[model samples]
Target: TAFAGVDPGVNESGSYAPKSVPTSKRGSSNLRKTLFQAMDVLIKTMPQDDPVYQFMDRKRTQGKPYYVYMTAGANKFLRIYYGRVKEYLSVLPDPS
Candidate 1:
């Protein structure tokens, strides 16, 4: 999604239906690049039992290209990060 910027795009017809995955131009390219590099490092250093690496390995075994695997991993990382951060924030004491 927004993390990797690969959210699906609406068709040219402008209906609600999405037709293809398109990179959104709104986010910081540097952050995307950092996520990609992090993904590469994770694949190299993480244990095989790690869920993220397992997902990447499954995609690799399925004949997906390197970029595809990395991008998917980055997206997964972002989704996890979002969920964890949201939970952490919700537990904070109210300032009011």
Candidate 2:
């Protein structure tokens, strides 16, 4: 729901719908650099060895640092977010 560098070589602008994968913020027709920047914020907010990173790196452990390897980490976060959204699609079945 924000805009900025969400990737290294991009400055995309658009809502992040879970309809497809966001490999690179750059060259994306609807993405911007801000998106990458936004993800960078998450990197700053969270710890270097946070469980999120663990979840992201669960498949494989490269010699690169977690923050430095944000491409895979962010991709994992996105996938995790998608799963959470699906798991909690409704809050108490809409008590309006």
Candidate 3:
């Protein structure tokens, strides 16, 4: 849901494809809102050594807008969630 909601759309038609990150309105509004809020808290409270914090800090230094950085963080959060869940499921015994 976060992936659907937060990821940018690709434009593949033009000779020069300018990269853009448009805020998508295609997924669960509630989930998107919650993720955005969670990211805000994490950004404020997470230590500098944390990778998400480092990513956000880099974006800040690069002059990305606050909301853009927050959305990127949410996208990162979803990818991490998927990876951990996949790993956990892989370790579980199969049902007969």
Overlapping backbone residue pairs in candidate 2 total: 20
* Model 2 misplacement above 4 A: 1-35, 54-61, 65-68, 90-96
Better of 1 and 3 by lDDT: 3
Cα RMSD to native, each candidate? 3.0, 9.7, 2.1
Question: lDDT of each structure?
Answer: 0.76, 0.52, 0.79
Angstrom error at residue 49, model 1:
4.0
* C-alpha RMSD between model 2 and the true structure: 9.7
Better of 1 and 2 by TM-score: 1
> What is the TM-score of candidate 2?
0.42
Candidate no. 1 TM-score: 0.77
How many angstroms is residue 57 displaced in model 3 relative to the true structure, after the best TM-score fit? 1.5
Task: Give the winner by TM-score.
Answer: 3
**Residue 44, model 1: Cα distance from true site in angstroms:** 0.9
| Residue 61 local lDDT, model 3 | 87
Q: How accurate is candidate 1 locally (lDDT)?
A: 0.76
What lDDT is obtained when candidate 3 is compared to the true structure? 0.79
Candidate with the greatest lDDT versus the true structure? 3
Q: Give the range of the ten consecutive residues with the poorest summed lDDT in model 1.
A: 3-12
* Regions of model 3 farther than 4 Å from truth: 1-4, 10-21
